[model samples]
Every structure is written in C-alpha cells, then in structure tokens.
Target: MSVEVRAVPGESLSFPGRITRVAPPRTHWAPVYRRRVVVADVVAVVGSTLFAYALRFGNAHAHPVQALLLLGLVPVAWLAALFVFRAYERRFMGLGNEEYDRVLQASVFTLALVGTTSWAFQLEIARGYVIIALPLGMFTILLLRYAMRKWLHGQRDRGLHMQSLLVVGHRQGVLAMVRQISRASYHGMRVVGVCLPPAADGRLGVEERALAALGVPVLGGLDEAADVSVSAGVDAVAVLPTPEVDGAFLRRLGWALEETHADLFVAPAVTEVVGPRVAIRPVCGLPLLHLERPELTGFRRLVKGTFDRVASGVGVLVLAPVLVGIALAIKADSRGPVFFRQERVGLEGRTFGMLKFRSMVVDAEARLRDLAASSEGNAVLFKMKDDPRVTRVGRVLRRLSLDELPQLFNVLLGHMSLVGPRPPLAREVAVYGDDARRKLLVKPGLTGLWQINGRSDLDWDESVRLDLRYVENWSFGFDFMILWKTLGAVVRSRGAY
Candidate 1:
C-alpha cells in the first residue's frame, strides 16, 4: 500500500511508485526510546544510591528512616541535573558518540552541583559516597543506554524504527544512495522511492530491476519528488548531489516538508568527511561547511601513546602464558623459529621489524611466488583459505589470531599504537596511491578498523578506504570501540584465512 509525502521542484509528474509492507509508522519512536532511557537512568540512579548507602553504612540502619531518606534525595537531585543538561533528549539517543558525551556531561554537572551544595550548606559529604555513587550510576546508565542502542539496532535490522526516505537527485546519485542505505541497515534509513533531476533524464539508462531489488522504486522526476514523498509516507526527503537541490529549492522544500513534519536531509557528493572535522555555519543565509585539519600531534597523540603503552603492557602480562603456549605449539608442529619477524612499513615510510608467532611454514615466503598465480587474496595482499604452506599449528593460530600476540611487544616498544591503520608490507607501500599514502601519518596499529571490519576478506579498495577513514578521523573513543569490536570479529573468525 501507499502513504503520502512531497515532490522536489520542476519535473513532469507521473503516477508515483510505492513501497509496501512497511511495519506500522514509528515517527514518534525517538520519544518512546528516550522514555526507555529515562526509565533506565532512574533505575541506575536508584540502584547506585542504595549501593552507596549500603557500602558506606554497612546496612547498620544507624539513623533508620533518616539515613534512607537522605540517601534517596541524591537520586532525585541527579535526575534533575540530567534533565537540566538535556541528556534524556531524543536527539541524542541512538547515534554516534553524542549519547555518551551527554551522559558524561550530565553526570559531571550533577557531581559539580552536589559538591557545590555540600560546600554551601557546610555539610560534610562523605567522599566515598560521592565517588562510589556517581561512578556506579554513570556506569549503570551507560550500560542501559548501550542495551537500548543494541535493541534499537535489532529493531531497525528487522525494518522497524526505520525512517522512510525519498531520494531526489541525479539517477546515479539516487541508485547509489539506495544501495548505500540498503547496505547499512543499522543506519535506519529506508530509501522507499526516488525522483531524478530532469537534466539527467536522457542518461537515465535506469534499470528498474536493479532499483526494485533494493525495494526502491523510481517515481518519475524531481518535480514529482515531493508528491512521491507524501505518497510514500516518507519521514525524510534526501536531496542528493544535484544542482536542482539548491538554495531556493531547499528553502521551499523545507517549508513544504515542515508542514508534513518530514525532514530534508542533504548529502554532498563527498564521502567519509565526518565526525568532529565538519561543522555547518550560516553566512548570509548560506550554510557553509567548515572542515578542520586533522591533528596528528600534541596532547591527543600523547594520550594515545600512553594508552598504547599501558594497555599493551597489561595485555602482554596477561597473555604471557597464551603466548608461550602458541610458541611451543608452533615449535612442536613445524621446524621453524617460534617467533616470526618481518619488515613492515610504519609511520612516514619507516621500516620496523613486526613480530608474530610463526603461523606459516619456514619457507612460506619462498613459496609465495609459486602460489602467486593461484592466490585467492584481494589485490596487493596474498591470502589463501587452504594454503598448503600453513602448518596444522599455524591454522589454529591464525584462526584465533594467537599468531599476532607477539605484536603486543610492538605496541609496547613505541613501534606501533594499539589502534591505528594497519602496518603495510614494504612492497604494499611501494605501490601506494597518493590518497592511500595518508595511512602513513600515524604509527601502524596492532589492530585497527580494517582488522575488525574484515581482516583478510575485504577487497583492496575497501581496506584502503577504511584505513584512510581511520587516519582522517582518529580519536581515542573510536579506538576503544574498534578494540571492543575486535573481540567479536576474532571470535567469528570472519575474513580470516
């Protein structure tokens, strides 16, 4: 069946194609999700208060009802601070790092207020209670929000909580966006229909089957975009790269969609330029996007370096026995050295000896040329799922990535960061593209975006794209997330040979 939306400006109207079987409309879901988060915050705050009270007083019931009442006041005051900071707002609930940032903001603001109040009232607040309760509440709140996000992602994957989108742009742009949005189901955008710009009509060469395969039907031209949007129950009108999606058109489009309570989302042709690097400021009614130069040096780098050193040290210490076991297995299964050291290209094209537990035959490198013609790997890197050179021990080591445990030393030695772009083979760097050379800006990582996304399985272009994306948008939080995701990726053993 069909629902209604608006048209883009100026192309002939045709009977609009429609999307079907969309689960009921979820336009008000953000608020519903926000409410869940609010409830979670309350649970977290209350539990933390009780825990703090117990931790401090040991269930002594020293003042009976008075102590319980005093402890209860903290949660009420904390919730008020969260409300004042707008941490419970719907806009910050589902995407990016903003939710965590808001939670932290609210928590710190509450803590500050608590401290100030205690000082003003000349009441001696127990430091243990303040420290324990604030951290526990914050941790519980973040855990609950993470659960909510996971639940939301699950819903979106099954076509719930998705924003219906009408794409208005060139034929290529519409198709590309449809496919892109389809691939990233967690993005929660469903491109239900498309409206092409008139100038590109002759170049249409549009394949109905290809677009329909993604459940996105093209509905005439840009003139009918608004009408198609309304007909499709579109929640957002995506104006892709096209001259027709200009200032006057967008201004009017915004007005029309506002009446429908639908949003106008514009996408420029450029990709991967996101996060803290981009900002939009209006000048003379034109919204100008400001791009910041990536900072590779200074305090953040020091923070990253310190984190790498400390984390790698702990990892090595904890994994010491596992490392020994792998080395022993390799020694028993094959006639080669337990450790493998290969020259790899690092930051600024410097060469470093990258270490690993040997996960291939001693003559694996010598045998590479013989297998070159039969290589099943992506371009540049050579990999084979059933490579004959891999010993039995090597297979198990590679499967669980136990072979790379020695690289913790690389991270500890200042040769690498715990998370950065993958260290390139010297030969890979030799033929690097101008754009790919940006991967050399930081220390190579023991693991990174490329590693977690798909180790040996990603195509050369995708691998390079991920590396470049990481180089451009390096942040400590991003690194931590990648590291967290790495565990799942390793367990699944996907893309690993």
Candidate 2:
C-alpha cells in the first residue's frame, strides 16, 4: 500500500498515515459545468427580459413590436457582456467571490451598453422598461448562478466532478495539503497520490508506514512527479514549496506537465494569505509573489466604519418591535436586567463593553467558577450546553441567536462592526499568542466567520484560525457574504446552544 520516499535534506518530514488507491482521473467536469452556467445565464437573462416586457408594455401596448425587438437585443447584449467580462470562463464557473464579482461587473456593463446605445442611436427605449429589465435580469442571473454553484457543490460532496490531484513535496507538506483539501470539499480537489523526495536510506521508515495508513498512494520520487501524474491519470499536480523544489525544478515540471492534461500548481510556503493581498509578478522570467499589507486604517476603514454605523442604526430601527418583545420576555423570565454588558477586547486590544440580551440568571457571573470545570468549550472559551444559570427564555433566545441582536447598538455606537473577527473576552485576550492577537488589528464584529462556520462547535485553534482568516481578508463583499450566510446559520441553529 506504500513505497519509501527519499527524505529531503534540512529538516526531516514525516507522514503518520498510510497511502490509499488513486481514483481514475475525471477531466470532463469543467466543460460540462461551463455549459450548465451558459445555459443558466441565457435562461435567466431571457426570462427576466420577457417578464419585464409583460409588466411594462402589457399585450395591448402600441410598442409591443418594438418591445419584442428590444427584448431580443437585450439578452444578446447581456450574454455578450457576460462573456466579455470573463464570467463564462472555466476558471470562474465554479467557486469564489470572483464569479459573483464578474457577474456584477457584467450586469453593470450591460446597463451601460443599453444606455449608451439608445442615447447614441436616438432610439425610443422606454425609461420604465430599461429600469425594470436591467435590475430584474441582473438579479435573476445572480440567483441562477448561485443555484448552479450550490448544485455543483452538492455533486462534489458526493465525490462526483472532482479534479484528481497529485501532491508532490516532502511528507509533512503533502500531509498538510491533503488534510486541508479534504476539509473543504467545495474546492473540488481530491488528492489521489503523492510524490516525495528520495529518502536517505532508500528504505521504508516510520514515516512511510504512517503515510501507508492514510491510504493516499505514494507514487514515486520527486523527480518522477510529472510522469507519475500522467501515468496515474491526475487532473492536477500540486507541488508544495520546499528546498528540493527550486526554480529550475519547477520550470522543468511545468514543461513536463504541458504534455499531459494535468495542470501544475505551486503552493507558496506562506499560508492563510490569499485574495487581493497576494499577487504574482514575473520579473525577467522569474515569478515573484508580492503581498500587500492589510488595510487596517485610512479610507477603507473610514468607509467600513460609516457603513457599520449606518447599517446598524437602520437595523435597530427596523427591529425595534422585535427587540422590545425580547426585552419584555426576558424581564418576565428572569429577575435580571433586560440587557447584559460584558467587557470584551476590541480593535488594537482596547476594552469595550459588549451588549447582548440577558440570557442567564441574575447570579450567572457569580456561578461561573462552579461550572468552569464542566465546560464543553475549548481552551480560553467557557461554554456549557445545559448550564443551570440559563433561564428558560434564555435557552430559546440563544438557540435562535436573538440574544446577540442588541449588539447592533454596539455596532451603531462604533464599538463593533457588522462583520469582522469575534469579540474575544478580556480573559481570552490575556492568553492570546502573537498570531491570535493579530485579530485585534480590526474592530470586532457582531457576526463573523466564526459565527457562521460552527460557532460554539469549533475548537480554540479552529476558532482562532477562522477569526484570523477574516481579519486578514476583510472586504465589503466578504462581509456581505458572511452576513448573508449568517442568516442561514441562525436558521439551522446547528451549534447555537
């Protein structure tokens, strides 16, 4: 089930698992998925245009013939805009915000095209028709694309339409890559085999036996990676950064993979740095990775702050009735104050009083010491599924995450953001390491990656990782996506005790 892989020099790498059988390569997925997207886009655009035509002109309108002509032109132009924006490209058909981002761009472009063309040609395009059709078509396209993405993910979860991946690197690097790929099936990468550097002894060692346990096949040595990928029928080859994988080796590997259908990917040693921050630059035929510093201040921060305050202000007003009802329920359920305020660490390690609905008994703080030992939470976080201090109403509120609603006021008061890292308790901050403290670079959030990912179910390491990822990759679009998903998480109530 396994073969000895030569250990590269410098530090010894080990994989404490066994190798498994590699699946037959599946390369037909991208083309089929791209076709589905194209059909969906056309349907969405055409359907929205027809609906708008009916709503605006009706059957008896005198401009019915003209409207029909305009309708045909709009869909054609819309699809062309989408194509021009690279929305239909294979790279953008499946995952990431890039797909949605491109769709939005295409929508804006289509709007511009319609307006400019009508203005230049002096065509009698109805203002009402233009307004209705553009917005409806944009919304429909986004909706259908989202549905298609969900379907693709569901198929991937069932091990269908996955790219068979061959990992080439030292044992430890290979193991980390494989483990990460396994956790996020939505990425559509299925690790089939690995190629490691030649071991010094040329004999199966403890690491080899360990890798044998995990069942990912050890195909061959590093030098044979390209051949192994081709022979094993892999869709892609991921080469982890190591001393053994120099620029020359990578160049050769790239040239080698050009003959096969498999794509070559070189993973940088730096982890958790992606999106806009990392960019590849080629200087004199050498590829250089440039990482931009996180924008924690200046114009972006000002914009985010303004948005947080405005959104929270409107949110509080909109939810006034619900908030009042919750306050009354809490007063009737327990002998405590309607609101709970706890000192939490915020931006730059400053202390702020976070607001929440009172979800526990009057003496809950006093009883913490007694239940600390039985907490089900990970290190630094104290949580209990069935604590005696929780009032009956408190449990219901917590389950629905209604208890955190008052934090909107915190957000309005500039104490937190609508989306960012979770506000850590002062006690938790006391024990935070350098990496964990990096989360303090930005304002804490009412809901964040931690909230939607698993909430209380995630361990300290996982919670910190998610928080760090959010802090490092904060964007308006990312924040909006998190806010949207938070609604689903709240409804599911999976880890919300």
Candidate 3:
C-alpha cells in the first residue's frame, strides 16, 4: 500500500504506511544504526563492571552473589543516567564535544547515585567493589565512546549514513545554507533539493547556480516543496529563515509537519555566535537569543593579560643571550642601531612606537622614498622581496622572525597582546577606508592571523578579512590555536621575507 503525505515550506511530512521501500542493497548497519551504539555502551559498562568486581574480589568465589548484584545494577544505573542526560538523541550524536561530555557526565552521575544509594539503604556494598567498579566503568564508557566516534567519523568521511536535507527559503538564504552545508559534509547534512520561496527576483545568485551545477536539485517555489521532499525521500527539512519567519507562521508550519514524521530544523540569521556563546532566554512569551559579548575586561581579561605578561617576560629573559648575540651580529654586519622603532597605530587607534630588532640598513627609511615607485606591497604598504636595504644579519633575522622578539616588551607594557590583529603602520592606517578601521577595535599584536596565514603574501582584501574575523570571533582558545600554528608557520617561513 502507498501513502501520500502533505508538507509545506519549513515543515516535514511522513505517511502512515512505509513511505519509501528499503532495498536489500541499501540496508547497512554502520551509519544509521544509533541503537547499536546505545547497545554497545550498555554492554561495555556491564563487562567493565564485571571485570572490576573480579579484580577487587579475587575470583568472585567468596562473594558471587554480591558481584552479580553489582554487575546487574551497573547497566541499570548507566541506562537510567544516559536517558536522563539525553545521550541517545541522534541529533547530538557524532557532532561536537557535547556528545562526549554527556557520556562523561552520565557516567559520573550514575556512579555517584549508586554510591549514595548503597550508603543510604545500608546495602553493605563493599568499598572495594565501589572503588574499582566506578573508575573502570567510567574509563570503559569513555574509551568505547571514543572508538565509536572514530568509526562514525570514518563513515562520514566516506559519505555514508548522512541525513538528506531539503532546504526551503528565499533564493539567497537557501543558496547560502546549501553552500555552507555542502562545504561541511562532516556535519552529516546532504542537501538533496532547494525550495526557493516565491519572491520578486526569480533568478538565483551565483552561489545557487554553483550548487545547481553540482547536481543538487533546485525544486520550485515553497508551494511545491511538500511534493518534492516526499518524492526525493529527504529525512529532514531545514528552513533557511528569512526575516519573514514570525512566531505565528513558524507555529503553523510546525503543525503542518506533524502528519509527516520528517524532522524540522530552523537556521537563524545571526552569524559569529557559536553554540557556547549564545543562550536562549524566553522572556515573557518571546524567545530572545542572548549573545554574550566577547569579554575584553574583568577576570578573563586579567587572566589573559597576566598570562601574556608573564609568558612574554620569561621569553625575553630566556632569550636574553640570543638577543645580545643578534644585536652584536647586526652591528658587525651593518652600521645601524641594534633595534628599530617605527610609528604604528595600536588599540583604539592610539599611536605607539612599535619596536623590533633592526633588520634593515641605517639609511633604509631614507632609501624607501627612492624605491617607493617600485614597491611590491599591497600598494598602500611598502615591501620589496629582494630589497637591497636588508643587511646580512637582517636577512637571517627576518626569515626566522627573530627580528620581532623584542615586541615581548611591548606585550608587557600593555601596548600589545600575545595574540591580536597585526599592528598597522601609521601610513597604512591613513589609507584605510572606514570599514578597515575596525581592525583597531582591539590592541594590535606582533603576530596574528595575517602573519600565520602567509603574512606578506596575502592580498589587501584577504588580510583585512582575516583580521576582522579574528576580532569578531576572538577567544582565548582561538588565541592558543593561532599561537600553535604560528610556531609551524615560522619554521616553514613561507611568507616571511
């Protein structure tokens, strides 16, 4: 028997009877078998508890009843905690650290609950059993989850067991959503078709055309999306929300999807707000998304600043002998001073004398005007790959980025950070357009996104984009990542001249 389901834009439809038949060739136990993962977790917990019991009580010969009881309760407690923690939800599986975090939390909660219950009920549970079993169960659960995650990731990499999605929204919004999903296939969304909402402009953007060329079907307007989703056999419908998705229309769409068992997903318009930074606060009757502003002050700022100062201070102290040797090398190779200071724009557009160990001739600035016409930099900036102004010692220093080591002092003086936007010269800031001024929103750094990402090799637009992206998405974790990458970039010296 065949059943028909009716769906709408932003809604899902499923028929009462099997809407689609599964062929023998299509059936597999790898990707879509979420039940298998839960079963594996339960078995692993039970097995580990049993082993722990044996290890703690010899062969369980003296306390067979007690060992069996504890092993039996382990699975029960774990399953209960997993359900309470929503660990089995397919939506959260194989994505982000949240899934693993829940597994740990559930294990901890289960162990605590079992311990507390034994004490309160006076069950005379052996301390050896509790001590050994708890850690063993927790470690086993984490290890099993990690192994499952690796297996799932392999499946995703091979394009198996992914959810097929029907994108529905205005042409631009749908196209944007399609591009993002296609680029991040590890997220497990396969865009099967796009349902463009009726609008004045019938033409799709360049992005949409590119997606269409890649064989993603472009279904007609929203009115026809229901039929398309059913025909395409999509598992979910993601509504790429335009400004028009008000509460009333969203509610109605939810009601329409009830007949179809397909899941519904809503993509918000806000960008740069990752899961950790956004909180949904239901004020009165409206769902208000509260985005926590990037904290640049208070305890976090204090900690970051303290870390920067102490780290930079120690770096300078450890590298003092190297610094002295470099200074002597510079003097031996050229007549220039040991260090150079240039006027640069810093935080909030404040002017500062940015210091670096000298890597140019004494008359380099004077010669710059003569060589200005042949400048190879981004036009506004001045750079020459084989400039004659570089001294013998300067060449080595520049290549290894030893020239900027003195900026550790700048970080200690609060004039810079261990990580931030690249400090712009005064001349560069003068030529910056209004949009470019946003780079000064935070303190400039000695090395940053531009430095690690090919440094002088990047075009003007690309450099500015990276800098602004850093400002918008600044986090302590991101800073550490940049720092780690910087070490590798320095070793390669890809863009360091």
lDDT tens digits, residue span 1-497, model 3: 22233233453322221233211122244345577777777777788777777777774363565655687766787878987998877766777667777888898898788778877887767778778777777777767776777677678768876777888888766766676576557677777666665445534356455655756655555655555555555677887666656666556656666666567887767654465567899999888988777665578777877888999999889999999999899888878689999888898999988899999988888898899887777756677888899988888999999999999999989899989898998878888998689889888887788878888777787688778877767778778878977997899897787
- Superior candidate under TM-score, 2 versus 3: 2
Q: Give the alpha carbon lDDT tens digit for every residue of 187-230 in model 1.
A: 77787677765443443254444675665656657766665666
What TM-score quantifies how close candidate 3 is to the native fold?
0.64
Model 2: per-residue lDDT, tens digit, 1-497? 34444444553434423333355745688888888889888888888888887787786563664666577888898899899999988767778888988989998998888889888987778777779888888888889889888899899989888888889999877876776688679889888778887677766655555566655667788888766776676788999988889889988888877877787888888777788999989989988898898778899999999999999999999999999999999999878799999999999989999999999998888999999999998887888888899899999999999999999989999989999999998889889999999999999999999898879988898899889988777778889999999998899897897
Backbone clash numbers for all candidates listed: 15, 21, 2
Please list the residue runs of candidate 1 whose C-alpha ends up more than 4 Å from where it truly belongs after superposition: 1-24, 27-32, 58-69, 171-179, 198-215, 268-270, 281-287, 366-376
- Error (Å) of candidate 3 at residue 355 is 11
Worst 10 residues of 2 by lDDT: 11-20
lDDT of each: 0.79, 0.84, 0.74
Best by lDDT: 2
The local distance difference test score of model 1 is 0.79
TM-score list, all predictions: 0.85, 0.86, 0.64
Ranking by TM-score: 2, 1, 3
Maximum-TM-score candidate? 2
